[model samples]
Target chain A: MANAVLTVRGIVRSFGAFRAVDEVNLDIIEGEIHALIGPNGAGKTTFFNLLTGSLPLTEGEIRLRGEVISGLPMDEIARRGIVRSYQISSIFPDFTALANVRFALQRKRGANFDFWRSERSLESLHGRALELLDELGLVEWADVRAGDLPYGRKRALEIATTLALDPQILLLDEPTSGMGREDIGRVVDLIRKVSKGRTVVMVEHNLSVVEGLCNNVTVLARGRVIASGSYKDVASNEKVVEAYLGAAHA
Target chain B: MAGTAFLKTTRTAGVSQSQFLGFTKARAIFFLLFAALIAVGPQFLYPIFLIKVYCFIIFACGYNLLLGYTGLMSFGHAAFFGMGAYLCGYAATQWGLPFELSVLAGTVIAAAMGLVFGWIAIRRTGLYFAMITLALAQMVYFIAMQAPFTGGENGIQSIPRGTVLGFIDLSSNTTLYWVISVIVLAAVAFYNRIIHSPFGQVLRAVRNNPERAKSLGYNVDRFKLAAFTISAAMAGFAASLKTITFGIATLTDVSYVISTEVVLINLVGGIGTIFGPVVGSFFILSLEHFLAPYGPWVLLIQGIVFTVFVLLFRQGIVGELQKRFRTHL
Candidate 1:
């Protein structure tokens, strides 16, 4: 906890009578790829939403670099270096892959309000956007519309946009969801490469991906964290086995 | 071969760089042609009809800023347009303000209305947003009906054409025509600048995906509010110009019918394209002018035209042209 870049304590999100995320606690250390895994209806996405400020928490505190950001708006939270990507492919469909990245860079550079200047004048930002696309192996897809890209490439483009923000902490919800095995492997590698020198808290359903990439894993079941530790430790935990892996195998 | 090569070289050399105020070389040429048309238009066409077309073109362009670019369909734009007319008329008649200041007053008032209405309405989206705007516009219509300075049902009539900049007596039709043409052209150019600016990019991004734009650290509501205010201000500018041209501000200008008409104009022209509103304004205005003698049949004809456009040319005339040409017209 001493090196924790993001700390979530007693985070609770209740929808009417249903407690979607109940009293969760987590500590994400700097430069760690931490995974949140759970069976369907186990509150993984809700917990992710709570952490990203996409949903209001019923009760809890979220601190980023020791600053309380529990109730801040999503954009404000992103501005404070906690950016998130959706479980679905969330890149702007109509925008070219290059433009998708440039928009994020534009926000990072505080050039969003430059209404009088030509968009071409923002060409300086394109270098960085292209760099991000190149980093994600999307340089070939740069001019292609994000919506027109194949599913795997669209996920990669989404990551490229997320990276453009230069976030200190990145939350990715199901970054490899709906991808084929080959695409999944590519994205797993993409995530590992991009997590260098940055903190990532991802909601991943692929156990192999978690084992291969995550430094630590948190298992949630019935809206509560049932186990948390190294992948080996949490995977073998009797409660996690009973609640998630047991159900998966059954 | 040498002669052909020389011709090609000269053509390329004569082509202007695409960096002139964000317009491409082709677009710049198109703009020049457009300017020429505007310059010579009044001579051939009915000058008064041309003035009306320009006013609606400005109004539709302003409406498009929100509906077309920002993806917000406001059904209450007449509130801004009508407010501009009434406010400008009042300023000219009551305060005896010059032409320019009266227009300025109208524009500022409409912008202020936009700020307030946008704040309240942007909390909702889609049909809810449209309905809120429609309700607010109706409230404005009621205010216009009962307000004493607005001349009630009779409306503000016979507004004087005050001198521009304390000179250039606007009494002459030709002089006023030139002035309106210049103002309309400048506004269109300004709109073009905005559509190609970083702010416009962000607005489009917000329109495409509000959630993604927010995740990128943009305050989406703030951007929407800004677009709404700017759109309202432009609509107000158009309204004031119309009032000055006709020397009257009527309740019909602020009515719900006017709001729907502007939406129709944008739809018929092209919702998001830069010149769509201009094409739509001319098309609709020409229809109205030509069908004036048809009496009640005009409404039937207009309805049929709208239905056909929606069914066959939903992207609109300009949108269809842009699609076919593979260019951003």
Candidate 2:
């Protein structure tokens, strides 16, 4: 097992009588692309929410580098270098693409409190921002309003916004949910490039892309992990086959 | 590290781009020239009228700071403005504090008032927030009406316009005008600084997508609170100056009507435009003075103007000019 950047142990989240996320334990190592896969309503996003501190854990300890971050506020968690991207693209729609990214970057740089100083002097922030745009192939649409962008581009921009936070661990919920084949390919490539040397935990449904990208895969069904292993191992397991592939195979 | 760096860089770019779009040297130049005009205008125009206009401009600018850039509509701004006026009026009259010190006291009090109101009201969003603030302000207005220091129905009258810097007698309308102009200029510059700074970007970000801003690591509540405080102080500063200039402060300063009037001025000028409030203040003040001869007809005309501005001219006068000029500034 590689060194875990984030560790979730005995985590359970519930609402009333329903257990949205049952006792779940997970570990994400540095520089690993860990794929979280499950059917709709399988508590995947709920788990993501808890991991990112958007929701409180009913019973668990979540640690970032051995520091407990179970119920910290979302912003505080984010400030500690853990951030998340939403399934629905949440961005500053009226702002230009670059502007949305810049907002996050400014937060990271502590340029926000100085009222008299012009932000233009933050050259390194700008230069690095443009470079990120270039990397995401958003250089052409840098000036476009985020709202005006196509769905795929908006998703890409959401990711770009998340990346600007310089998170040590990125929890992405449906990074390519509404993407076309061409966009999916481009996004997958960008994800690969962006996730280099950082831990990425994503909830991706596309099996092929999951297979191509994720080094480790965790599968959930009915609010509990049914199987978790290498794609080959999980795909070949009898329980996994009975739970997922058997329905299709039959 | 790559993903982290990528996210950080993208955020910076977005902020830099927004800063470039709305903030420019052209806007700065316009403000500088406008301040110069205000500074020297008492040489010709009636200093009393100019001071009144200056006060209104500050009120409009303060109100717009929340509504325009932060996208938060506050209906209770009159509470802060009135509170400042009453404080300045009471302090100068009763305590016999120095002129600038009294005004400063008013601003500090207003900021504290804003903090309390913001803490409670910000728990709600959109129209609910507006309503909550309005209710709170109405409570304040009633208190001001009944408070002993406020002189109840009559309000604090015959306020002393204490000498500026303990030397220059502000008894002269021209001297008072100069003092008001200097304060107004400083307030406008402060506004410009805040809206163009990185803090402004965060406000706009929260304005655009608060949930997104929170997930991206900003303490969104802090930004909102700070904005509320600064805005309240500016409004209070204006009111304080008005109290000193006019040598009186009354319930009129704290009324819902005054609140609506500030909004009207901003709406008539432009919401987001920096110099719009100054232009709007002058336009509306002149119209009011010119039509005073007609009594109630003046309000009727003002109502008609308000309706016209709301229905047909949403972008306002300066906004329209900026559009025509195709200049972002």
Candidate 3:
């Protein structure tokens, strides 16, 4: 068994009486595409929120490399090599594509608080940002404002931003939630290329996407994991079929 | 990363992909233009009037830092501004400190005050933040009204413009104009440099989305406090310079009107743009000058302008111009 990069044990999140995430346990191992598949409102977002430290866990232990990270702030957790991309493409809209990536690169390089040096002089940081942009096929549009980008491109930028963290583990919320057929293929290719040696856990609804991209799959039904394993193993599970794959079977 | 690039191209393809206003170039040009204008302006215009404009411009710009970059609207900016004027006025008139030293003193005190007030005020957000700041400024106003040294109703009358460096007599309005202009220009330049810096970028990010910024490995609160301190100090600097020019400090400095005026200036010009405060100051000051004979007409005109712009031009003057021109900064 590969070493677990992140472990979530008995995690529960409740909005008053409504349990957004029931006592769910997950161990995402290093260097594997683990897809958290579920129906709409299966608490996928809330679970991702808890994992990324966006929302606090009610009663659970989340460990990154066996270190407790539940009580830490989102930024602190991100700094420790675990980062998540947003579903809504949260980026500095006014900033150039290169500048947005530069910002992410700046954080990873450290020393942004320094008031002395001109930010433009951070040459290495700029170079790294440029390289990352090139890798993402955004080199031509590096100078373009992020806000002006199309929906598909913005989603891609969101992923690129997460990659800038140089994260050992990545939590992606609906990486291809909104994309045209061509863009979806492009995103799948990008994900496959980028996921090499990096641990990726994503919450996606597209079954074909799950079947194609995910090496391991966990089915979340009403905030609980009904079945989890390889795609073929979970596809045959009757409980998962009734709870999540009802429309797929139909 | 590839996704962002594709998005950028597709997005820019729809619109003209020409670079928007480069913030760095715009900032440098703005400070340079102002410095040139102020340096040469007093040669033609009334020196005392120019000095007044300088003071208010600095005051508005300081207010802009809080509202524009940090996304925190303060209704009580006049409180800190007035406090600075009062402190500088008192130090120069009573304690016999050098004009520059008194201004520095005022700035330091204002910064300390900002730290305390910002800590308290920033605890709340949105409308509550505005109310808290206003209430705090009102407290300062009341204190200024009752304090014995503040000269109560009459205020500190006949405050000496004092000898600059205890040598050159500033009794000449022209000489004092130059002095005040230099201070204002410097303050504006400093603000420009700050906004263009990395710190400023982080501030804008924090303003846009505090939670997201925090998640991206930034300490949001620390940035907020730092920005608050810097803004307050700059305001104090402007206030001290104003005292030097006018030779008096009054309750008028801390009045609610001063606070509202600063916000209006920012609103008229453009809240986030570097040139917004300067442009807004000139327009408002010129309006006030033109309407001197009309009394309440100035208020009426200002109110109309505020309403029209708030409803019609959400981006303010400079922001709208940038949008139209497709400049990126």
Cα error, residue A244 of model 2, in Å, equals: 5.3
Task: Tell me the TM-score that candidate 3 gets on chain A alone.
Answer: 0.94
Error of 1 at B228 (Å): 0.1
lDDT per residue for candidate 3 within A1-250, as digits (tens), equals: 3598899999999999989899999989889999998788888889988987889999999998889999888888888887888878887787777777777777777666654444444445655666677766667777778888888788877788788887888888888888888878878887888789798999888889989999899988888988999999998888888876475672
Best by lDDT: 1
- For candidate 2, the docking band is acceptable
lDDT of 3 by residue, B78-128 (tens): 777888888888888889888778888788878888898899988888899
Q: Compute each candidate's TM-score over C-alphas.
A: 0.94, 0.89, 0.90
Task: Score candidate 1 by lDDT.
Answer: 0.87
DockQ of 3: 0.30
Q: What lDDT does the true structure give each of the candidates?
A: 0.87, 0.83, 0.80
Question: How does residue B287 of candidate 3 score in lDDT?
Answer: 93
Q: lDDT of model 1 at residue A142?
A: 70
Per-residue lDDT for B142-261 in model 2, tens only?
999888988888888888888878898988877777777777887787777677777777887888888888899888888898888888888898899888887788888888888788
Model 3 CA lDDT for position B59: 79
The alpha-carbon lDDT assigned to residue A173 of candidate 2 equals: 88
Measured against the native two-chain assembly using Cα atoms, what DockQ does each of the candidate structures obtain, in the order listed? 0.36, 0.41, 0.30
